[model samples]
Target: MAEDVQINWGKVKNIFESVTERMGQNPDRPAIGAPKAKVRVIKERLFEAKAEGHTFQIDEPVERGGNGLAPSPMAYFTAGAAACLTSHITQSAGFLETHYTSLEVEATVLWDNRRKFSIADLAQASLGIIYNIHMESDEPEDKLIALLKHAEDGCYASDVVRNETPLRAHLIVNGDEMYVHKNGAEIPDVPAGPTFGDNPTGMSKDEIAAKKRDGG
Candidate 1:
């Protein structure tokens, strides 16, 4: 008698969970690429997040004193994961000799909490990216999947919060004026410090820009 072959999805999911979900960021607080300007999020996370006039939405959850006007941290986890997957596939596919057309990562974040946007008692129940590929090309499915595995291995943001990567950011303020970074580096070569709101705690954007110029 020939035995029936059945692929267990649970086992597959378990494997992904066991391996990728446990690998934390390579270097905690590693410097990642930042935008010179804000870029619009072309996609949304379960209608909780949306693109609006070229900005990634940031809002506190209902419990935290926000109007729930924005998506929560779990939502961000989903968004960042999907975004990383798309970017990784686009960049790594061709180099690995795979014909891939498009890819979209859809994540379902089920936070085990009554408090919205809270990480406490939270969970990511679903995670996977569907690749619309042109696998009819020379590369085999096994090889393409292997490349994807490798690329996912390098995605840090997805692993950062999930694996609890160590991070910290210190601030130095003067009279409600936010301080710029000073590492004894040359002008135009120095890294940018954190940015603040238009009318932040103290100085206006212009005042802050001027302060940067004066090395204040």
Candidate 2:
């Protein structure tokens, strides 16, 4: 449990699926189905959320006519990439008994949608990560390459994106958390949040919206 970690990067692959697993229901008691998570675009590109607790918020800069108060949702692209890279580095560094002084992950969304530069059409994935890394002492170039490959191979997100996986997302206009799976149970909409388009003062809007918009 030291700061340095170097483990088989593939080992961490299971982490993502486990963290994002959804509750699968058996309608027919002994029925079977897939073990996939659900995603719902809460409000335009403004917010794309899921029950798994990860959120992708679309923000615009001042020049884009938006308030610029929020960070661009695509920026989370970098964040997600970094988190995955960090996990790989941590696991790898631990097993290798090495560490990185600085780790910087960057993701550049390449917009290839000639029809319309829509965020949904744009691709989001980890471009790469630079780890100012080294062993307790200097290591050979070949050894470093091996470690880098380990990090690359350990990136589960990359694998999933490179090899497109079947996507299934459920959109709930007004789903409620109290009755997420309960039929005929729906949450109500109170007054709008504090300001325009914002949630209430002390209430979780996602929870509210999940109830009010997506309905319970």
Best by TM-score: 2
Per-residue alpha-carbon lDDT of candidate 2 for residues 169-188, written as tens digits (9 for 90 to 100): 33455673332342333433
lDDT for 178 in candidate 2 is 38
Q: State the TM-score for model 1.
A: 0.42
Badly placed stretches (over 4 Å) of model 1 are: 1-56, 59-73, 114-139, 169-216
Q: What is the lDDT of residue 60 in candidate 1?
A: 55
**Each candidate's clash count:** 0, 28
- Model 2 residue runs over 4 Å out of place are 1-58, 117-137, 173-216
In candidate 2 the C-alpha lDDT for residue 52 amounts to 39
In order, candidate lDDTs are: 0.49, 0.48
